[model samples]
Target: MAKMVTKSILMPAALAAALDAEARDKKISLSELARAALSDRINLAAIESRLIARLDAQDEAMAKIIALVSSLEAVDEPEGGVTQ
Candidate 1:
């Protein structure tokens, strides 16, 4: 047997009606529809977090590259391209 858990949620009347209609179309209970919606939200959050982390890493790498280029530019070059 499966266990059941109860939760309370508040939503705007229009949104609630939409959810009910969608649930009816899917032939699923309102509870199931709500659970699926919540699960989808959790999945989206996880993906967004990963994307943010990757962007941050890329930004850090770019900053390091810029610093290296600046340091090379600051070096003094001999009058001649090659110093014998």
Candidate 2:
């Protein structure tokens, strides 16, 4: 049975005296330290959007292993005794 809402935010007297000295060093209550700093900035923006989609899938798997090592260095052999 908990539901009590009230609104009015205009901080800036030095950020409301640094959110009232961080709600008196965590004893909480400046509205639960502004709802735990807005729920830790919405859980750090959902963990930085899942670490930027796993760093864009490891940069598309290193661009397909640098196009298979530039197509095996443009193959070109067989000049004397070996071409198998």
Candidate 3:
């Protein structure tokens, strides 16, 4: 097991009520639900950042490939524009 420390967060009544309701609906403690939700959101944010960075890095390469394809000579339709 990993060592853990307890922390407390304060929220508005409406948000707290919503979280508590969700926790009850799922039959889990509010603490567990909040932990899982918070962890998932943080992980998704990090993954999104990494994905954007990778795509940005490839932006130039992708543009070059597109330009190369566009610069290719267009071929006319062969033999009545249809063939068996």
Instruction: Give each model's whole-structure lDDT.
Output: 0.57, 0.53, 0.53
Model 2 / residue 24 / CA error / Å: 30
Cand. 3 TM to true fold: 0.34
Which lDDT tens digits does candidate 2 get at residues 1-84? 111111112222434555576578667778876677687832434444454454456556766888888766555434553456
- Residue-level error in angstroms, candidate 3, position 71: 71
lDDT of 3 by residue, 1-84 (tens): 111111112123434565676678778897887687787732434444554454455665766787877655224336465456
Q: Candidate order by TM-score, highest to lowest? A: 1, 3, 2
lDDT computed for candidate 3: 0.53
Residue 78, model 3: Cα distance from true site in angstroms? 90
Candidate 1 stretches greater than 4 Å from native? 1-42, 77-84
- Regions of candidate 3 where Cα sits further than 4 Å from its true position: 1-11, 41-84
| Total clashes for model 3 | 0
Residue lDDT tens for model 1, 1-84: 111111112123434565666678789998887688687832434444554565456667867998999777666555565456
Clashes of each: 0, 0, 0
True-structure Cα RMSD, model 2: 17.3
